[model samples]
Target: MRLRGRKGIRETIESQHDLVVLNPAEWKGRWAERFGNEKPIHVELGMGKGKFISEMSVLHPDCNFIGVDMYDELIRRASEKARAAAGREDGSAPDNLALALFNIERIADVFDEGELRRIYLNFSDPWPKKRHARRRLTHAGFVRQYVRLLDSRGEIHFKTDSRPLFEFSLNSFADLNIRLRRISLDLHKDGPAPDNVMTEYESKFYEQQMPIYRLEAVIGQEALAEHEASLALAERQP
Candidate 1:
């Protein structure tokens, strides 16, 4: 399905200027100041339509949330939904939520070292073609970048309906010696917990009785160093 082109998306975003930051690069390394608090920051990459992250800001008031997506239209849609959800009865979005428009590959440019406490990847694009393996968000290179942006004990929580993508991500994390925990192959069948906030896609997939794979991975210093060393060694090889 093609996305509906949003007219005046720029104006729409500007209207919710506090809720959406159009130029994420300018705020790099100083996101905490922008949030006006020292609260732990969490981000959701590919946060389609903003369901998960918006609800997250409401649920965890102490933690700031940033939802990143590449498309202007998607960000516009997400901005509206999130503002509506976070708004007071009179109409005001939460101070803890913000949305960024940028490709995930430039994530490092938007966040500095150890600036994030958690990262969420929900129903991300599978990028199934073998030739596009490197483009998958869970690819080694991306994982390495995530590790750099996360503080000690920070974790990445991932969920997907694609078996191949889930399996590939599992292997990718293992190869980096990252610690994996709380894995579930059929999330809905296992039953939703109070803490399980479903995204728009997650809800639809659950209604369709499709299995959802989920896991939490921790990238400790040792694991990150090991992965970097391996990459270095591979680079020096003929």
Candidate 2:
């Protein structure tokens, strides 16, 4: 759900410098230093409105969280939510969370190799058209970027209410021979796992009794080799 252009969206986002990262690329390889800690980092790509990441930051103070969205309006809203989650009325962000405006295609420029422990893709755009498949978050190209950013023990946690997208993502991972675990075709079949955090879209779908599909793709040695090979093949293409 893309929001309409709010009147001072850009100004609003710029004002929250403490919570929003204005230039993410400059902090590449130094995210832990940005947070002033050495805790593991988890990032949520395309974090719409930020209900999930905000809650996750509050729930797990031991890990640092970065919420990335391309829209200034969405980032602004997410910043307010983060502040509220931290119970700070003085506009300070949570110690463990940072929001950034980023285009996912250039994600590699913002994080160094093995910088992330986990990546979240919650209810991402399905991009139903065949020609647009490459734009999907779970596409092989994006997965390759994720593999580079994630450490050996890293994981990609993806949740979606769109069955077609779920199927596409599963097949994409399979083509790379990536290891997957905790796959649930109907994630809320037993009524919301205690450990599950719901995004705004997810909560709406859950209320309407929609089935959510989820999977965790683990980064293993085989996947690493495959990603490296793909990168080499791309380098040789032209």
Task: Tell me the number of clashing residue pairs for each predicted model.
Answer: 0, 0
Name the best candidate (by lDDT): 2
Record all residue pairs in model 2 with backbone atoms less than 3 Å apart, i.e. clashing. none
User: Candidate 2: where are CA atoms >4 Å away?
Assistant: 89-91, 220-238
Judge candidate 2 against the unseen true structure and give its global Cα lDDT, from 0 to 1.
0.91
What lDDT tens digits, residue by residue, belong to model 2 across residues 110-132?
99999999999999999999999
In model 1, state the lDDT of residue 25: 92
Local error of candidate 1 at 66, Å? 0.2
- Give one digit per residue, the lDDT tens place, for model 1 in 110-174: 99999998999999999999999999999999999999999874889999999999999999999
TM-scores for every candidate against the unseen true structure: 0.90, 0.90
